[model samples]
Target: MRATRLNLMRAFAALVIVTLLAGCGFKLRGSNGSYRMPFHTIFLGVPDTSALGTELKRNLRAADDVVVLDKAEGADVQLVVISETRGRQILSLNNLGRVREYLLTYTFNFRVMDAKGAELLPATEITLKRSMEFNEQEVLAKEAEANLLYRDMQSDLVQQILRRLAAMKAPAPQASVPAK
Candidate 1:
């Protein structure tokens, strides 16, 4: 009888926990899914060979409602990558003047336009930075780690671009005036 009562109490407690979680509107990560893009077809102005460009292409392709075009012609929207740059700087130095830490930065400038060459979204810049500790003994490993971090940053930037695109509101149609 005691064991049965203990099991019943544990089950009741688990039920209460689940009910509380459900009532609080808890949602799992990525449950929101892909955001809707403003335009149906979009042209990526960046080169396909670049890392950011390639990843952006892949991500845009994942959205079911958005079509990534090869050229700017006849596209509903054109995304122009004005500039992209990557840099590293020494953050800290050791007693012997050796580098003890480094900061890696990636910056991207981009904008959106319509088929008629009117700007839809003005130029925007996104910058991401990361710091890493350096040790001469782990040169190769540190280099690999830095490369991985850069790739991760690129992925994050792609997501940011997508979210920005999703947030964009389509411009209202201009009214035409009749000539007197």
Candidate 2:
């Protein structure tokens, strides 16, 4: 009889917790449904094999209504990747002039345009930087860590691009007035 009562209490508590969470509008990340793209079809000007290009394509393809095109001919929107660059600089040095810390940076530039060559979105640059402590004894491990950080930053950049594309607003239609 006691065990049955305890189970009932536990079930009631769990139900209350779930009800509170639902009332608070709690949502898990990436569960907010597909991001709506302004254009149904988009052409990516970056090479398909590039890291950023591949990530962007994969993300765009995930959206239910988006279609990524290879050629620009029939696409409604074109995304031109202007530049992608990565750099590393020493952030700190030991007394013996050995590097103790480094800053890694990745910068990507891109623009969006319409089929008629009109700029839909101006050229913009996104930069991501990370700092890490360096040890001479862990050179190989540090190199691997840097590569992992870059890959993580690339994924973040892709998500940012997708959010920007989803948030973009189409120009309002204008009403023409007859000339007097």
Candidate 3:
């Protein structure tokens, strides 16, 4: 009886913890794409062939009731990619002078503008970084690992941008012109 009671208590504790987390709006990274983009139609400035552009489109597709267009024509808003830059620096060196660690950084600058060219979001920058240890014997593996870290940072950047878009109030309705 005591063992059963202890198990029940543990389960109840876990349930309470989950509830609290939900109430506080805590979510796992990239687990949920529940944000709704304010714009009904959006045109991404980045080229479709780019990896970052592809991921951004994929995530934006999950936004409720939003249309992502292949062409800028007929789009209600445009998302401009100001710039994207990556950097790597030696974080540390081994006793023998080989690279022991590297600091990886991905910087993204972007903004949102309406069809009328009014800024919904001024230029904003989000930088993500990850530090990884290097192994001389695993050059190939380390390169692959570094690529993975960069991808992870890209995903993070997308999420942050999505959140910002969702937080903004929907753009003021544009006045429609009467047919001539």
Candidate 4:
């Protein structure tokens, strides 16, 4: 009878503690959730890089859990690309007038910012490309080539963005010294 009464008291105490904790709004987020920054809301400002901006927004939407916004209105971060350059080159050719080993390059500036629009990752350029045989006979095939190249470029851009996000690190925790 004593043990049962003690157990009941313990259970009542535990319930009271849980109720107090719940009233205080203490939430037990997951492990990964603890490290997550308040980065859910984002604003994208691309200037003349509108096309690339659209592609970036799509990639961020599909690959990241961020919510993109227009301008900096009610956002946690801002992503921007300042400039971009695109070029193409031919790497191979056949004796029968067939061209092969074409390469495409795209260089661009990127930046991440806080809600106040302060730069987090300073302006930087990332370049990516794709190369393939150039066929002059089939225009439809050339169109396919362009599509592939664009896809590669988008993939590369997405990788670069994710890399930046992963590279973010919080400040190191301070150590406490024990007095001898």
Candidate 5:
């Protein structure tokens, strides 16, 4: 009988602990206040219909937890990133007028929002830069390499989003006020 009573007491304590945790803002998602909703429907907004968009969609699909939606009306969440490609000067030519090195940079302005219109995560901007030695004879090969670099950059961007989302905290329940 005493053993049964002790087991019951332990169960009761566990229930209480769970209730308290629920009252607080603790969730399974991450440390930050982010909801772990099964956000299957996602709306992606990009500046233009480019390879980046295609690659981003493919990576998100591979995640299996997210579904890229065709429209924004009923999306569980939204991901918007304005990407701009720019030519960067990494190295200069010598006195003989021979090119040295160059870099290509792509900057993305990104954000993710929940369905309730709350800013789950504010817009965070990040840039991906790739540098390569200048070779006038192999410009085509370099351009091909640039595409591969962009693909890697897309993967990195996805990882950044996942990290930020994972670190979000869930909203805490409000305490009821007694009548005055």
Candidate 6:
């Protein structure tokens, strides 16, 4: 009887906490990366093999079943990726002139526009960089670590994109001028 009472109390407490959080308008957008976009239909111009693209697509699906159009003809917004670049540079050298630290960079440029090409979100560039210490003794391990860091950056970029979409305002309706 005591154990049952304890379990019931715990459940009640959890329910109260969830209700309070909801009342406070606190939403946790983590892991699932769900967002509320201003537009309903969107066309994303990205390849299937792209990690960021895949993550973005998943998030969009979670966002109220947003329409992912293959063509931009009927989309409310068309996302265009201008460029994606990855680079590495030597940051420091050891006493023997060997590399000690390296900087890895990821740059992404994108824009959102209507089917007629009016800009919704102008061209925005997001760049991420991480400094890695290298050791000749652990070449394979260091390579793996670099790959992990890059993957982490890709995930961050996806979340950033989602936040931007969530914050975007709906496009203003165009008014036609009467012919002279």
Deviation from native of the Cα of residue 172 in model 2, angstroms: 9.3
TM-score of each: 0.82, 0.81, 0.83, 0.59, 0.62, 0.78
Residue range 1-180, candidate 3, lDDT tens digits: 999999999999999999999999897864666786677888999976788889888888877888889877678888899999999999999899999999999999999888788898899999898999999899999999999999999888888888898887677777788999
Per-model root-mean-square deviation over C-alphas: 4.7, 5.8, 3.8, 16.0, 14.5, 5.9
**Residue pairs clashing, model 3:** none
What's the lDDT for all of these models? 0.88, 0.87, 0.88, 0.70, 0.68, 0.88
Evaluated against the true structure, the overall lDDT of model 6 is: 0.88
Q: What root-mean-square deviation over C-alphas does model 3 reach? A: 3.8
Off by over 4 Å in 6: 1-32, 172-180
When summed lDDT is taken over every stretch of 10 residues in candidate 4, the lowest stretch is 29-38
- Per-residue lDDT of 1-180 in model 1, one digit per residue for the tens? 999999999999999999999999998965675777767888999886898888888888888777888888767888998999999999999999999999999999999988777888899999999999999999999999999999999988999998898888774444466999
- Global Cα lDDT for candidate 4: 0.70
Prediction-by-prediction clash tally = 0, 0, 0, 0, 8, 0
The candidate maximizing TM-score is 3
Which scores higher on TM-score, 3 or 5? 3
Q: What local lDDT score does residue 121 receive in model 2, on the 0 to 100 scale?
A: 84
Model 4 Cα lDDT, one tens digit per residue, 111-133: 77776556677887888877766
- The sequence of per-residue lDDT tens digits that candidate 5 reaches over residues 1-180 is 999999999999999999999999787754452334345667878634766677667766766466788887677677766454645665668567977777767677777776656666687877877786777789899778877776787767666666665456542333456999
